[model samples]
Target: MTMTNTAPAPTVWATLQANDAPALIDFLVNTFGFIKTAAYADGDQVAHAQLDWPEGGGIMLGSYKPDQEWSRRPGTAGMYVVTADPDALYAKVRAAGADIFRPITDQDYGNREFGVRDPEGNLWSFGHYRGEPHP
Candidate 1:
């Protein structure tokens, strides 16, 4: 039997730790057009940052410090973002010199999507598919 909840879905957020948080912030903003909603820096390192998409959704980020237990391998998180216009976003990412991991294609799941790697090698994907509602 399938079980379903009627509660609203919780907002899901992702955080990435970059060696150069400030630079990463700039890169995300410049390349993906993410807006820095809030940022705190400790000198050259970004203590914490929150970047938001124009319509909705966002991600948290900070500088990677070996001292932190949460630090992961450099540039290893695979991220997916929803976009209103996958084609347009793909063009921007291409112009930004992103290394295309997967060229824009219509997925069997119905998403017109593409994937790329950021300057630090983190994988990111943008797609027009919004998954079907839970039953």
Candidate 2:
């Protein structure tokens, strides 16, 4: 054991709360191609769920409670997920229930990307790197 002066940015497992987490998780997996890695239910309905990203990260799903701030209101902002085919994934997400906020198009600065809003109003984005994405 030794001491070092270096630290990396925290990695987060983001979870969104919706009315029916099972349904929402299903949509993400069946439609957008996420894979279920873990899940738990409070009886028969999903209480907590996890989805594995095809590329690298992960997402969690849980039933929304009106008492929580993120649950009380719809989400307008969302973190983007990387995809090999952004255009195709965008179309798929739209077909499944996402509202297209911005059509897929190449940016002058870099990658081709699109914006969408989910059924519960959580913003979803799919994109890939042509160069770099701003952080």
Candidate 3:
């Protein structure tokens, strides 16, 4: 018998709201390497957007709307993204002049990681930790 290994597609997504959704999308794409998969908009307001990380998984975001029932405060979300190359990413982010709150460093758990604040004030942590295998 032969078996094929397959990684599952991401189902759960990290989501946030941005004051300037379009600019935030550009920053994430140019600075963090996120691919802009889709973005829905209404004039100056973005209704929704999907940005996929090159490695795996992705994030969803939209324009800030405090009056909406599902409204989320802009700049209040924090996310952790897994990456294979922290040093290279750190260099790119630094060159882009992003606000890095935590410098790239090796963790006691054997992962290399760094943290930054986006233009919208959201916190993002990137690391090499892939998490423990599922039981």
Candidate 4:
């Protein structure tokens, strides 16, 4: 006998940062069709927020820290997010105040991806992670 366990595939999620989280969340919701599912807030300050995307997808967002230097800096390393539509998402992100690093292009490694810089200077790279579906 043969058996299989099937589940909806999971995609890569990005842990991003924005100096102005309220504005960032507003831009994401209004422009990219993303919705805030949950958040950790302090009065008017958004400590961390979760924005859900399609395909059982989501991203975790936070504010910039003075001592945290690696993840949220412009010239430093950042997070890569895999989405179904990189071009469309890139456009939405760019229109919502992100700085486009490059046009959406099919990468040599078998992904159509693009990179953009968020308000707090973190680079958000959107692409399709070329791999087998999760079991």
lDDT (C-alpha, whole model) for all candidates: 0.87, 0.75, 0.94, 0.70
How many residue pairs clash per model? 0, 0, 0, 0
Over 35-104, each residue of candidate 3 has an lDDT whose tens digit, in order, gives 9999999976999999999898999999998998988999988899999999999999999999999999
Ranking by TM-score: 3, 1, 2, 4
Model 4 score (lDDT): 0.70
Name the lDDT of candidate 3. 0.94
Candidate No. with top TM-score: 3
Question: 1 or 4: which has the higher lDDT?
Answer: 1
Model 4 TM: 0.65
Clashing pairs in 1: none
Off by over 4 Å in 3: 1-5
Off by over 4 Å in 4: 1-17, 64-77, 94-97, 132-135
Candidate 2 worst ten-residue window by lDDT: 68-77
For candidate 1, write residues 1-135 as lDDT tens digits.
999656553388898999778888898899898999999987988888999887578899988888878887659999888899999989998988878999999998788999988878899989987778899
Model 3 lowest lDDT segment of ten: 4-13
lDDT of 1 at 116: 88
**Which should have the higher TM-score, number 2 or number 4?**
2
